[model samples]
Target: MSAQLLERGALRYTPAGVPALDATLQHAASVVEDGRPRQISFEIKALGIGAITQALGALALGQEAEFSGFLGQTRNGRGLLFHITHLVAHPMPANAL
Candidate 1:
């Protein structure tokens, strides 16, 4: 997904001493849902672990990027977290279809 890094917490280490980063991603796009045009905008909590944590930690807030990852339950098991595994820094602007 293409998203903007809205906010991030200080870089922290996991219990096993592995790097971890917690962030929020904001996404906005237009799509067709149920045969009708729809505008979608939302913010999601995200996590970058291992080496990816360093890269994600280096980004400035509001930076746009292409993120590839999976969704999983948050630590508290009450919310979802986008587990970012790969990303392209400053992806090209989106083209209108």
Candidate 2:
């Protein structure tokens, strides 16, 4: 999904000492719902592990990018977190250049 980086927590390490990062991502898009045009927006908690953590950390807050990952429960098992496995930054629009 394409999302904006909303918040980024300090980088930390897992129990085994693997790098980890937690962030909040916001996604907004328009879609057809029941043949009707609809707009949707929401925020989700995300995690970046290992090498992905470094890349995710490099992104500035509010930056937009495409992210690919799987969903899983947070460590506390009380919330969901997106485990980012791949990330691709969107190119800047020509007008912005």
State every prediction's TM-score relative to the real structure: 0.89, 0.90
lDDT of 2 by residue, 1-97 (tens): 9999999999999999999999999999999999999999999999999999988998877878999999999889998999999898776556654
lDDT of 1 by residue, 1-97 (tens): 9999999998899999999999999999999999999999999999999999878987777788899999999988998999999988794345611
Whole-model lDDT, model 1: 0.90
Clashing pairs in 2: none
Task: List, in order, the clash count of every candidate structure.
Answer: 0, 0
Query: Cα miss at 48, model 2 (Å)?
Result: 0.3
Q: Listing every candidate in turn, what is its Cα RMSD in Å to the true structure after a full C-alpha superposition?
A: 4.3, 2.0
Worst 10 residues of 1 by lDDT: 88-97
After superposition, which runs of candidate 1 have C-alpha atoms over 4 Å from their true positions? 91-97
lDDT of model 1 at residue 39? 96
